[model samples]
Target chain A: MTRLTRSAALGAVGMLAASAPAFAQSIDEKVNEAFANSTGWFVSFIFSPFPGTTFPWIVMWLVVAATVFTLYFGFVQFRTFGHAIRLVRGDYSDPNDAGEVSHFQALATALSGTVGLGNIAGVAVAVGIGGPGATFWMILAGLLGMASKFTECTLGVKYRNEYADGTVSGGPMYYMTKGFAERGLPGGRFLAILFSIFCILGALGGGNMFQANQAHAQLTNVVGDYPGWITGVIFAGIVFAVIVGGLKSIAKVTEKVVPIMGVMYVATAVVILIMNADMIGWAFGQIFAGAFTGLGVAGGMVGALIQGFKRAAFSNEAGVGSAAIAHSAVRTKEPITEGFVSLLEPFIDTVVICTMTALVIIITQQLIIDETTGLYMLNEAGTAIATVDGNSGVALTSAAFSSAFGWFQYVLALAVILFAFSTMISWSYYGLKAWTYLFGEGKTTELVFKVIFCIFVVIGAAASLGPVIDFSDAAIFAMAVVNIFALYFLMPIVRGELGSYLDRLQSGKIKKYN
Target chain B: MPSKIVVGFDGSESAKRALDFAVAQAKAKGAGIVIAHVLEWSPYSFLTPTELEERHKRRGEELARAETALLKPVVDSLKDSGVEVSTALKYGHIAETLASVTKAESASQIVIGRTGHSSLSSRLFGSVAGSLAQAAPVPVTIVP
Candidate 1:
C-alpha cells in the first residue's frame, strides 16, 4: 500500500513537471484576461443592479417561500422525516402502492438526480461567491427544502395516474393538470404544459448538457483533450442504454450508485480533512471572515447573505420541484415515505458534500481570481462573461483540491465525470417523467425524448455552454417559483398525510420487521 | 466455530445495532468479539497549542464516556456467550483504525451496521462498506 501510494505520488509529480511549462503559459494568459474582463465588465454589469439581479431575486423568493411554506405546513420537513425514514424502511410496505418503484428506490432515484453537480460545482460556486457564511444559509436552505420536497412529493403521489396496464405517470404536469382541475383552478393545463416544456428543456440543459459539459471540461482539463466529443458520445450511449429500461433500470442503478457514490465522496473529503488536519481551523476562520466581512462586490453584509443563500439554494436544489418528479415514482401507498427519504437528499448533497468542497477550498489558499483574466470575478460572471459568476468552472474545485492533495486533481476529474454522468442520467429521467405526463406514455414518444436527450450530451460537450447552463440554472430556480407556490396551496394535504403517518409511528403500530 | 467478529460502537442507532448483532453472533458461534470506537480530534486546530490540546483531551473523555455507555449493553448481552469479549477506543483514520483493531485483537471478521439504504448503494461508485471491502485486508459483514 505504501509503495502504491508512493508510486502514485511520484507519477503525479512527474506529470506536474512535464506539464508545468505549458500549464504555466496558459495560466499566465488566463490571469491577464481575467483581470482585464473583471475590470471592464464586472463592475458595470454585475455589481450595479446587484439587489435586483435575477439570481438574487429568484433565490431570495424561493428561500422566503420555502421557509414560509414550511412554517405554514408546521415544518412538515421535520414532522415527516421519521415517517419518510419508515417509508424507506418498508415498515408500512404496501405492495399496492401505485408508484413504479419502492419508497426507498424513489428516494434513491431522486437523490441520484439531486445529488450530483450541485453538491460539487454548485457548492464550490456558492462558497466561492458568498464566502463561508454562505454555508450557514445553505444549511438553512436545505432544512427549508425538506418542506418543499414534502409538498411536491405528496402532490406527486396524490395526483399520480395509473394506466389500465398499471404504468405510472406523474410530476408537476399531473399535479397541475389533475390537481388544479380538482381545485377548480384555471390555467392548470397550460401551466402544466409549460412546466413539461421546461422540464424537457431542463433535463436536456441543466441535467444532460450541463452535466456533460462540466464532466467533459474536467476530463479534458485533467487528462488533456481527448476529442472532447468522445466523452459525450460514450456518456450518451451509456445513459441511453440505461434510460431505455425506464424507471426500473434507473431505480436499480440509482439505489446502488447513489449511496455508494455519496459515501465515497464524503469519505474522500474526510480523508482530505484528515490529511490536512492542521488547516481545518484556518479554513473555518477564513469562511467566517469572508462571509461576514463581505468581499465588497454588491455592497455590505446583506449582499453577502443573498449571495450565500442563492448559492446554497442553487447547490442543493431543495425546493426546485425537480427531485419531486423522481420521488413521485416510488412504489408505496404512503406519499410521506418517499418524502422522508427525499429529505436526506439535501443533507447529503449540501450539508455534507458541499461542506466538504467548501472546506477543501477554505483549507487550501486558492483565491477566486480568474485564471484566464487574473482579475477577481464577481457574482454575475455567468451572464456577463458567459461563465458562472465570472469564475472558472469545476476547475475552481479541482484547483482547490490540488492545492492540498497534489494528485487530487486527477481524482476530482474522475469524480466530476461520475458526478456529471450520474446527474445527466437522472435528469433525463426527470425530463422523461415530465414528458410522459404531458404526452401520452407511448413507447415511441419516450424513445424520441431519450434520443434528443442523448444528442444533447454530445452538443453539451462540443459547445461552450456557459450561457445555456446559466439559463437552465435560472430555469431550475424559476421552477421553484411556481412549484413552491403550488406547495403553499397543497401544504394542507401534506400535513394531514404526515399527521396520520406520525400517528401510526407514535402508536408503535409500524414494527421494525414484518 | 462461527467466525470471530469485531464491531465499532459510537452510540449511533446503526452502531448500537451492529454491536447487538455482533454480540448475538459471538454468543451463537462461541467466538471472540471486540467492540471499538474512534475519537477524532476536532479540526479546530487554530487555537493555541495548549488550548487545542485541552479541547482534544475534553473531546477524548466525552467520546470515551459515550463509547462506554454504548458498549455496556453489548457486554451484558455476551456475558453467557463464553466468547472472549473486549472493547477498544482509539483515535485516527476510521478504516485504518478499524483494520488495526481487527488485527491487534486477532479477530478474523469485521461487522459494520449499514446506514439506512446504505447496503443498496453498491451501484453507486463510492460506498463505505464497498470501499472498505476493497481496501481492507480482511472480510467484512455489513449488517443492514
Candidate 2:
C-alpha cells in the first residue's frame, strides 16, 4: 500500500532536486534586484561628487577630517609615537587599575578588526584601479588618520558610561552626546542617533556581509565554484554559535588563527620582496612617480588619490568610530593613554601592513606595464591597471604571492577565511552595541541584533548585492561624518588630558614599571 | 617575634593541607596567616569586543563567588583558631599575583599546595605551584 505513494513521492523529490538550482538562481536574482532598486538613491547620495571634481564627497570628508585632527593635535601621531609604543608595552600601567584589560589587549582586538580583508582585497582594489600612485596617498592618509584615531579614542574613554554592574560602554555615540553637552552644544542627541543608525547598518553590511562575500570568493578561487549560500550558511552558523549560542571557544580559535595568518601573510610578502630585491627601488619609484603623474593610469593622478584614501580609511577605520568602541574598554584611568596607544592602530594596519601588500603587488609586476610608453597599461574600459590573468582584489594579491611560492594560494585562502571570520565576530559585537544604544541595552534586545547580523552574513554571500555593499560603504563613511564632527568639538578636552598626562609623566606622578 | 606567612588557597584539598601546614608554622612562630586567593586570568587571550565590554562585570561576579564559596567558608571554619587570619583576592596570573600579595602584606614566607592539573594548558604554562616556586620573592614552602 505504501510502495506506490512512496515511489511518486520519490519522483517528486527528484524533480525538485533537479530544479533547485534554477529556483535558487531566480530567488537570488530577485533579492539582488530588490536591494539594488531600494539602495540606489541612498548610495548615490553618499558617494555624491565634491565640487568641480570626480572624487566622492565621502572620501574628501575623511581626508579633510584626518588633516584637521593632525593639525589640531599638533601632529600628535608623530610626537606620541614613542610614548604609544611604551604604553602598549605596559610601561606606565598601574597594577591597581580598576579593570583587567591591558593596553596590548585593547590594541590587538582593534587591530584584528581592521587588519583584515581591507589589507588583502582592498589594497588590490586600490592598486588595480588607481595604479601605484594610490599607495602614496594611502600611506599619507593612514599616517594622518592616526591623529583621528587618537582624538576619537580619547573621547571614547573619557565620556564612556560605566554601568552599576561595572560593564563599560563608549564610542562616538557617548562622546557625541556627553562631550557636546558639556560644551553646551545642540544636536548632540541627533548626531548620536545618526551615528548609531549608521554604525548598526554599517556593521551589518561592511562588517558582516562584505567579509562573508570575500571569504566565499577566496574559497572559490582555491576550490571550484559552488553556491555561495553554502559558504554563507556555514559562516552564519559559526557566527551565530559565537554571538548567540555563546560558544566563544570557536571565536577564540578563529581569533588565534587570524593573527598567525596575518604574520604568515606578512612573511610571504617579505619573502617575495626579498626575492625581487632588485625591483625594490623600482617599485618605490613607480609608487612616487605614479602618485604624481599616474603614469597614464586610468583617471590619472586623481583616480589614484581617490582609491588610495578610500581604501586607507576603509582599512584602518581610524575616523569611522569603530575602533573607539574597542578602545573604550581599556582599564586605564587616564583616557589619554588609550589615545596614545590607538595612534598605532592606523600605523600598523595601513602604513605597515597595507604598504607591504602594495609593495608586493608592484614588485611582482601584477599590473600590466605598457611597453612603448613606459607607463601602466589600462584595461579596455580604461578604468584600471590591466593585470596579469585579469586578476583583481584578493586574487590579484594571491597571484602576486603565488608568483613567488606556487602553493601560497592555499595559505592565502585559509588566511582570508580566518580574517573574514574574525572580522565577522568583531563586527557582530560592534553592531550589537549600536543596536542596544538605539533600543535600550538588554538581553533580548542584543539577541535581536545578533540574529539579524547572522542573517545578513547569509544574504551577503548567497546574493549578488552590489548596491547593498555600496550602501554599507556609504554607511561607514556616514559614521565618519558624525564622528569627526564630534571630534572637532571635543579635541580641546583631549588636549587637556594630554597636557596633564604629560605633566604627570614629567613629575613622576605616574610610575614607570620595570 | 610576630611575623606574617602568606598561604595560597583555592579550597582544594591540597590547599587545605597547605593551610594546615601554614597554621601550624604560624602558631609555632606566634605569627599571622594571610590567605591569598588568585583568580587566574591571561591578558594575552583573544576576546570578542562584547566579551571585553562585559569583562569587568563578570570579574566582579567571579570575585564575589570566590569569596563566598571558596574563601569565606574556609575562613569561617577556622574562626575558632587563635592565629590571626585575613584574605587577599585579585584577578591576574596566579604566581605573579600571589607573589605581589606576599610583597604587599610583608609576609616572611609563602605557602602553597602542590596541586596537579593535567590539562594541556597547565602542561604548557606549568602549574601554579610550579610557577610560584620559581617566582616567589621570599622563601616558598610547597606543602604536599
Candidate 3:
C-alpha cells in the first residue's frame, strides 16, 4: 500500500511538471497586461509627440522650464558655480555648530540617487538611439536643469515640515501644499496628491523596476542566460531583507560600495580616454557634427535634442523633485545655500559622469561611426548599433568596456549589480515617503508598501527591458510635469530667500568660517 | 579654583556614581567640577539625508535635556559643596572626545563611570574605559 501511494504521488508530480509552462505563461501574460495597464496612460500623456514634430511634449516641457529658470534667476547656475564648490567644501560651515547634514553629505546623497543605472544603461540608450549628438544636448540640459534644481530645493527646505518628533518629510508634496497655501493659490492639496501619486508610480517603475531589470541583464552577461525570475527572486529576497526586514548594515555597506565603485568607474573611463588620447578630439567632433547634421539619423537634430534632454532629466533627476527631497534634510538656516550645493548634482551626473560614459562609448568606436558620412553606421542588415549585443542598454555599454579591456565586462557587471542594488534601496525610501504621504504614516501601512516594493523587484527582473523603460520614463517624467508646474509660481519665494542670503553674506552677517 | 576635575556624564546610574566620586575628589582637592557630556557622532556613519537632518534636532534636544535634567540638578545638589561647577557638551567618539575635553579644559584628571554597554562591542572595538585610560591627557578614574 505504501509503494502504491508513493508511485501515485510521483505520477501526479510528473503530470504537473508537464503542464507548468502553460500555467506559468498564462500568469506571465496576465502580469504583463496588469503592469502595462498600470502606467500606460501616464506614459502616453507625458511622451506623446508635440504637433508637427518628432519631439515629445515632455522634452519641451522640461527644456522650457530650465531655460526660464536660468533666465529668471539671472543665470544663477553659472554665477554661483564657484560659490557652490565652496559650500560643498565647507568653507562657510562652522564645524563646532551642528548642522543636520554637511553640504557635501546632502549633495552626495542626492548624487547617489541620480547617478546609477541612468548614467550607465540610460545613457547607452540615448547615445544608441539619438547618436553621439545626444551628449551635446545632455550637457546643455544638465546646465539649465541646475537652475530648476535650485528653485525646487530652496522651496523644499523653506516649506519643509518639521514635526514634534523631530522627523522631517519634505519634497514636492510638502512644498506644494505649503508653498501654494502661502502664495494663496488654489489646488495646493490637489496638486500635492497628484504629485505623490506620480512619485509613487515613478519610484516603483523607474527607481525600482528599471534598476532590477538592468542589474539582471548585466548578471546575464557574466553568467549565461537563465530565467530572469530566478535572479529576480534572489535579488528580491535580499532586497526584502534589507528594506523590509530592516537590515541596515547591508544598506550601509552598499552606501560605501556604490560611491567607491562610481569613482572607479569614472577613473577607468578617464584612463581609457587617456590611453586613446588622440581620439578625444575626434570624439568631440563626432558629438558636435552629429548634433547638427543628424549624421544620417532620422529626425535630425530634434531627435537628438529630445533624447538628450529626456535622458539628462532622467539621469540627473534635476527637475524630477526627487533631489529636492534628498536636499531638504540639509542643515541650513539659509535654504538657498542647500540650493547652491544642489546645483553640483546635475553638473556631476550629466556634465561630468554622463559625459564620461558617452565619451568612452564614443572613443571605443562601438557605435561604428562612418568617417565619410559622419553618421552612425548601420549593420549590413541596416539595423542600429543596439542590435550589437541583442541587449542595447547595458549590453552596448558592456561591449564598449570589452573593446578596451576585454575582461572589463566582469568589472562592469560588478558595478552594475552594486549600482542597481543601491539604486533600488534608494528608490524604496523615496517610494515609502510617497506611500506614507498618500496613506497616513503607520507601521502596518509602511509594511504593505515595503512588501509591494520587494515584489516588484522580482517582476522587474523577470520582465523584458522595453516595457520597463517605457513605464520608468513615463512615471519619472510625469513627476517632472507636476513638480515643474509648482516651480513656476513658487520661484518668487525662492528668489526672496536667495536675495536675503546674498545680502547677509555681503554684509558679513553670515560669516565665512574658513 | 586652582584645579579642575572633568566628570563624564550620560544620565546613567553608573555615570551618577562617577559624578558623586568626582564631587568627592573636587572637594578633597579644592578643585572645580566640569561635567562633560559627549555624544557619539561620526561623519562617516552612513545615513539618509532625512535621517541626518532629523538627527541634528535630536542632538540639540539631547544637549538641552542633559543641561537641565542631568547637569543642573547636579549643580544644585553641589551648590553648597564649595566646588565650582560647569558643563561641556560635545558630539564625537565617546572616549576620545572625553579625553580631548580633558585637554581643552585644562583639567587635572578625569572621572567616568564603568559602563556595561554591549560586551560584544567592547570585545571587538575596545571599551570606553580602555580608550579613556590610553587617550586621556591626565589620569582617568573609572568609578565602579
- Which numbered prediction scores highest in DockQ against the true structure? 2
Candidate order by DockQ, decreasing, is 2, 3, 1
Cα misplacement distance, residue A67 of candidate 1 (Å): 0.5
List the global CA lDDT of all models: 0.65, 0.86, 0.83
Estimate, for each residue in A260-379, the C-alpha lDDT of model 1 and write its tens digit: 766777787788788889988877765566567654434345555766676667666666777766666555556666667777777666767778877876566555445684333454
Query: For model 3, how does the per-residue alpha-carbon lDDT over A341-401 read when each residue is reduced to its tens digit?
Result: 9988999889998999899998987776567865676555443443444447888888887
By TM-score rank, best first, the candidates go 2, 3, 1
The fraction of correct interface contacts reproduced by each prediction comes to 0.00, 0.59, 0.30
Candidate 1 stretches greater than 4 Å from native: A1-55, A80-83, A91-100, A244-258, A295-303, A368-391, A508-514, B1-144
Using TM-score as the measure, which candidate wins? 2
* Residue lDDT tens for model 2, A1-514: 1336634643454455456867765766776677678778878988899778898988988999999889987899998899899988878777665247788889889889998999999899999999999999999999999999999999999999999988899888899999999999998889999999999988988898888888878877875555666667767877887888899777777778888888888888888899899999999999999999888888899999998999999899989999999999988889999999999999999998999999999998999998899999999877778999999888999999988899999999889888988888888878877888899978989888988998888888776635655866887888888888888888899989988988888899888974
Task: Supply candidate 1's per-residue lDDT for A138.
Answer: 71
How far out, in Å, is residue B136 in model 2? 2.2
Please report the TM-score between candidate 2 and the true structure: 0.94
| Docking quality class, candidate 3 | acceptable
